[model samples]
Target: MGLQNTKAPRAKRANIVMLGLDFAGKSTLLYQLRCKDVFLTVPTIGFNVDMIEMERDFTLTFWDVGGQEKMRQVWSNFLEDADGLLYVVDSSDKRRLEEARKEFELILKNESIKNVPVVVLANKQDLPGALNAEEITRRFKMKKYCSDRTWYVQPCCGITGEGLRVALERVATFARQYSRSKETFRNLKEMDTL
Candidate 1:
């Protein structure tokens, strides 16, 4: 005898993919969003996934891309379908600043990912020698990108969860706006066909 289906269908959810360099505390930030303590974290070999329930209406799928030189080759595949981007940087690591700038430019140049809303997490603000939000903005020359879309250089302590909620909220808001604009464009195209 066949069994009867009784389970109710679930609501559709949205995904917000975040990509950033290695050791940028992406994983730590994800852990903090889940309200977890971070004693030790192993380097993410390929990519890490975290699901955060924002509300009854949405869910965020955070993809933390590995930052090592060898691992960066696979990041483009993930970037293609992302609705939003979060570029995380280690504010206290001065040596990687140039590398971060190069990567930022690369992302900006990519046609597929260029227009996506981005939130730059200037992480490790609790550490010594960490750059403040203004210094980060100045050094990275991020102000130019701000005009094209919603961009924020948030000073964050990933391990402690400080400023993480604000970062996520910004991403969520941007994602919503992007979705609406895309839908509007689609409708306009359909109307033109009539």
Candidate 2:
């Protein structure tokens, strides 16, 4: 018999939690990634979950949670199992920048997601007064607050899908790194016990 190869392709999975203030385009970004189309969405009172399959058997499942005042209290419930975070922001809502920054900082400080990778989507870049990625990063004080984790700010338009593909690519790369680090830590712990 001829030599045979029996290797199976590995599937990469990422459980990402998306969060932000109300009307920050979280739901719109979720649907846009899943359907590649703009969808009109009302304020999410609860949460929405969707799966997106990417090239090379990489699959991303996003949990888009409600950002209402009452809903924020339970956000930690979703954070416990997230492999990554996608923090959406209404770049055009200049007036709410401080509020968004406060919320973003709180999310990062959660113990469950202490070192998870974060992708801040500066959504609504097509609007008249939208902030750029640099501006969003500075306004949020990302470099100082996100020092313990891997993070990036991607300026995108949820309606037009601009910059979204690049954002996903960044998430995939970060997820891979995060997974490797976790695996390494587990291995080290097992060795310690041995």
Candidate 3:
């Protein structure tokens, strides 16, 4: 019986929630991460989940929450325990600039996600009217909310994976750091009794 029980069970996964407005290229980005070509693009009716296994025995489970107006109400449930967030924006859509700002503020103000680290993907950089990273930073008013944690505002063309690597790398690093900090705090608390 002891010899038969040598194999260990799989480790639990880490959760990462990514949110964005409709047409923000969230699904396209996910496909790019998976190294696949776009065949047919469709709006997500609800949230989608994708799991990625990283080096060092870490698995990242991504919750891609839909951004439709009607679906916004259900987003908080998924954001509640998110270890990190990725906010995707359509850099070429100038008309929605104000709306994007409002959405950004809403995410930051939500009690359930206030402290989560964020990585903003300024997507559509390959388009004609695409805004640069600095422009996105100014329009979103990110400085006000970026002080407490590590935040990355990167310009990306999700269809071609132009800046996707940088954004994903940042997310992984922040998530690992957050995990380490939690473990350290737990160890310190345990040592206090000794």
Candidate closest to the true structure, highest TM-score: 2
**Model 2, residue pairs in steric clash:** none
Candidates by TM-score, descending order = 2, 3, 1
lDDT of 2 by residue, 34-72 (tens): 888999899999899998887668888889999998899
TM-score of 1: 0.88
Question: Model 3 RMSD to the real structure?
Answer: 3.1
The whole-model lDDT of each prediction reads: 0.79, 0.91, 0.82
By lDDT: ranked, best first: 2, 3, 1
Best by lDDT: 2
Model 3's alpha-carbon lDDT is 0.82
lDDT of 3 by residue, 1-194 (tens): 35586677756456788788888889888878765565456888898899877655777789988888877778788887777888999999998867877887888888877667888999999999899999999888788877777788999988888988788888888877776676788899999989
lDDT string for model 1 (1-194, tens) is 99988977664344565556778887788788776576467778888788778777677788887888887777677878677888888999999888987887777667777667888999999999999999989988887755677777888998887888898889888877776777799999999999
Give Cα distance to truth, residue 172, candidate 1, Å: 0.9
Which of the predicted structures, 1 or 2, would earn the higher lDDT when compared with the native? 2
Candidate 3: residue 36 lDDT (0-100): 54
Clash number by candidate, in order: 1, 0, 0
